[model samples]
Target: MSSTAAFYLLSTLGGYLVTSFLLLKYPTLLHQRKKQRFLSKHISHRGGAGENLENTMAAFQHPPGLPVYGIFQARTMEWIAIPFSRGVISAVTIGTDMLELDCHITKDEQVVVSHDENLKRSTGINVNISDLKYCELPPYLGKLDVSFQKACQCEGKDNRIPLLKEVFEAFPNTPINIDIKVNNNLLIKKVSELVKQYRREHITVWGNASYEIVEKCYKENSEIPILFSLQRVLLILGLFFTGLLPFVPIREQFFEIPMPSIILKLKEPHTMSRSQKFLIWLSDILLMRKALFDHLTARGIQVYIWVLNEEQEYKRAFDLGATGVMTDYPTKLKDFLHNFSE
Candidate 1:
């Protein structure tokens, strides 16, 4: 090649590389603004443990004395209930702007409400909800564990599960956050159909930790918004530390995560090791930084941390700019918010 041509080619390649590096290094320069449809200040985890039932109508019948959002579990053709009663209606009646639920597909292609695919934890049965037909599913434990206490027993009147359609039929206006716990085409299709039938595209959100599932959910219904996958969350975290969050185009509209979950080793009397405590501390500093939360909120992404029922934790979550805090005790949250405001 001639010297002149070589010089021009080198300059063009160098310019392209420089531009790319700048964009990656300073993602805030390319921020694409979006309008957030929903903003929740309080989200109840498992419909809030009252009367000892996590997702039962008996529990939900007792409102939190104020307007607070709630999260429920969806299983295969069954709503969350106690042993032999109807509890699906409880979620809609709780008077929250948004209701979050976990969805799983049954062998019969039925989309139901449930948190765990395996029925062992919530229900005494050892079968997977997906493996069993609608009739084969068992009832929930009479006494379920509360979020705050390790082994507290509460009892509710309704124990029978309800169908997913039942919830839609009951609460047409309320927005719902569907957490796709199982990655299945049938489950996705069913959820999409329900959302469409209920005309709730603008109000519902698709939540899954898996990127693949998030993609499928979008493909199934592009109208509904989706939560960021774990990969994107981590990527955002990395970008936050590098100060590139302001320049990037953020597609995720919401972040739903635990404050700081430490899985203790399997043994009696589980406790966090020193390393675990350190990790939690590090996460608090990095993830809960006010600057990070402010940046995301400015970009219209909502931050929601879960399973926090204590007064101090609630204070911390909001102090860090959390749009919403999920709790297992609605009454406690209500009281806290009321007193905090006072």
Candidate 2:
């Protein structure tokens, strides 16, 4: 090679080596370096389902260290018994730092708290929650299914649906996460009203599965932080792998994801066909990487994995730099957390 060409090639190679070394040794150097506003060591999914009834006031009354996430269901000009009900007032009585609830709008444009818009699964009534006035809603079934295990049931004395306003009024000081279960404009608007009325702009977060719904949430109230939807999660994953994450701007503060729910589904009896299992397993393995968690943490974004009921999974998630583990069993999680200090 000519002298000039050789010199150019060597210089390029040396630069590449130096850059690679720096990235490997000081991984956080490229991150945004913003201080984290919130830190969640443990979160209660569905208000600690395994500990009590999922989304019930009973469940919300668990240990206080972790954040509690519940669902909202509402109706107008009527009322009914929701076994899991007790209103946000009861949840606030439990005294948690944060809470997450699902939001759905009734036919009358009232905001209610509930995980599903339909009332059949929880109440065993073949009716939609929206169609019924708050008074006409049916009581929850004698027993409710626990999210963590199959064929499990939660039985408690309280069974009445509570209004969203009740929650905002009861818990003015707490940070609450509202997961929009449906794409209803009225629901979004009603939620925004409550947030503004209570002056909880900094403490409220909007979450939903669809990107469109997430957008509506922001449009309704731009002040609160939002959780990443599935599409956003995929986009973030792509950026991370391409080394473009640090350059990209992310407005959302939380990434609440199921640890491996797609694969976890396989554990359900007779649900997974052989071929489906293999595909799910492969996908699970690929996404279960510590680097992804570490990268997001370095950028000051909180990574929370959900519905983890087992102790082993809790350890794995934390070891991989997860900011928090959302579990159905808050008592069990508290025990696990206690084990660490003792």
Over 1-342, each residue of candidate 2 has an lDDT whose tens digit, in order, gives 999999999999887667644553355676555555566676766665654555655555443322223321111312232233333334334333456667777777778777888888888877887897777767666567776665656665556566778767766776677888988888888889888888888777786979999998887788877889999988987776666565566778888877664345426748778887777777666566678777667667788877676667777778877887776655456556656446
Candidate 2: lDDT of 151?
60
lDDT by residue (203-285, candidate 1, tens digit) is 78886999999999988888899998888888988976665555667777888776763222222334657777778768766
lDDT of 1: 0.68
Worst 10 residues of 1 by lDDT: 70-79
CA lDDT of every candidate? 0.68, 0.68
| Clash tally, candidates in order | 18, 20
**Candidate 2: misplaced stretches above 4 Å?**
1-31, 62-97, 261-271
